[model samples]
Target: MRRLKSVVTSAVLAFGALAATAGTPAQAATEVRYVALGDSYASGVGAGHYDSASGDCKRSQLGYPALWAGVHDEYQLTDVSCSGATMADVRANQLSALSTDTDAVTLTVGGNDAQFSSVVQACLTKDDAYCKTATDWMSYYATHQMADELAALYRDIKARAPHAEIAVLGYPQALSATGTCPVIDLGSAKRGYMNDFADALAEGTKAAADKESVTFIDVRDAFQGHGACGSDPWINNLSSGTEVFHPTLAGYIAGYYGELDGAWS
Candidate 1:
């Protein structure tokens, strides 16, 4: 009778344990929705082919946003980045691109505000003496006014995507610090201004994001040895091809992978 009682007790305990396990609720998976916004780099202008259906937006399958989307299985992406977006574009135009359910957002802008294409064309047309003066003036304008505009844009993004993890992407080095484009002749002074311009814009971006308690992932350090001057060039010199001083495919991958690894991991 003692043995039978012990067996019954053990069976009862096991059944109770099984019942408890069965009654426990399963953990639900976390869902992430991503929205990408900004200018030509965000749209993957020089990296590769873009969505034909998207028109001048030129959003690419291989762009950083798409690369980020590919790695995160739980993320749903809505990319409305356009080729010629300005700071006003984010507040006025791209605001409509974001949804209330967005969990994460990323942006790259202000190069178009500098009128980069016009700068490059000016460099292509003018003599070296005049080109230096013109580029310097452009860089000064960018460093001063563009920084504030970029900050305002980030603020708008935060307002639009209230619940999202926001990141402001910085532009890679366009001209070589040590190397020169045969046509543009970006000397040390011009290169210094360009570097300063990029750095100022990045600083402004970080400050803006910090005000909103958002993350600012700096891509400059990640692309350190991969500028236009480096052996493994990320941004191509305009002289290299018609795409003219834009990121290569490998550059996009390096930048995107760095951002994803930092944000998601």
Candidate 2:
């Protein structure tokens, strides 16, 4: 009886040791919280109506950020992009939207700061050389100034979301080379200005990202043939006189997916 009891006790001890050895320490899951900040493009202004549950800021789930989040379910997203948002808006106005746990961020801004819409509007209304020259000068100043602002925004995001991966998106071309309308004409000079403006914004974004060691994804080349001029264009035109230029749903999807593939992959 004593021998049998000893054998059972030894077997139980060995089983407990085996169980302990097989057990492993639990690993912390990779937290991927996405915080989107910036202006109309980030807000998805031209995409469609906003979700009332999200906020009154007109943020859309169909926006690139949301689309990115949808595909990458691991991310917890906080999209605070609004139409007409300036650099100051991101620094000062978007604090409420930021969380302590953000792991990634993306933004689109500076066009409004350059008053790009106003430039397009002016181009549509005026034909004089003086107007064109004045607009060109303004575009130059705005481009440089916007670079500074973009740098500032990058700094702010770093400060707020230290662990987050940052991506500053560039604006896509708004008009076709052939022009959207005969009446609301966009000539070669104007087209050059717009494209140049986009290029400047892209450069500015890159400079800012480089300064902070942030990952800057350049979508300009990706969007080249897919602009308003393409047979299957991404940008939208004023169907009548009311809607001048914006992105179509397909355009937004392309932009969103491109960014996602670039960033997540």
TM-score of each: 0.77, 0.79
The best candidate in terms of lDDT: 1
When superposed on Cα atoms, how far off is each prediction in RMSD?
Answer: 14.7, 15.8
Off by over 4 Å in 2: 1-31, 53-56, 128-131, 179-183, 240-243
User: Scored by CA lDDT, what does every candidate get?
Assistant: 0.68, 0.65
Write one digit per residue (lDDT tens) for candidate 1, span 192-233: 555665665566566656665666777777666666754667
Q: Which regions of candidate 1 fall more than 4 Å away from where they truly are? A: 1-30, 127-129, 179-189, 239-242
User: Candidate 1 has what TM-score?
Assistant: 0.77
Error of 1 at 104 (Å): 0.7
User: Over the full model, what C-alpha lDDT does candidate 2 score relative to the true structure?
Assistant: 0.65
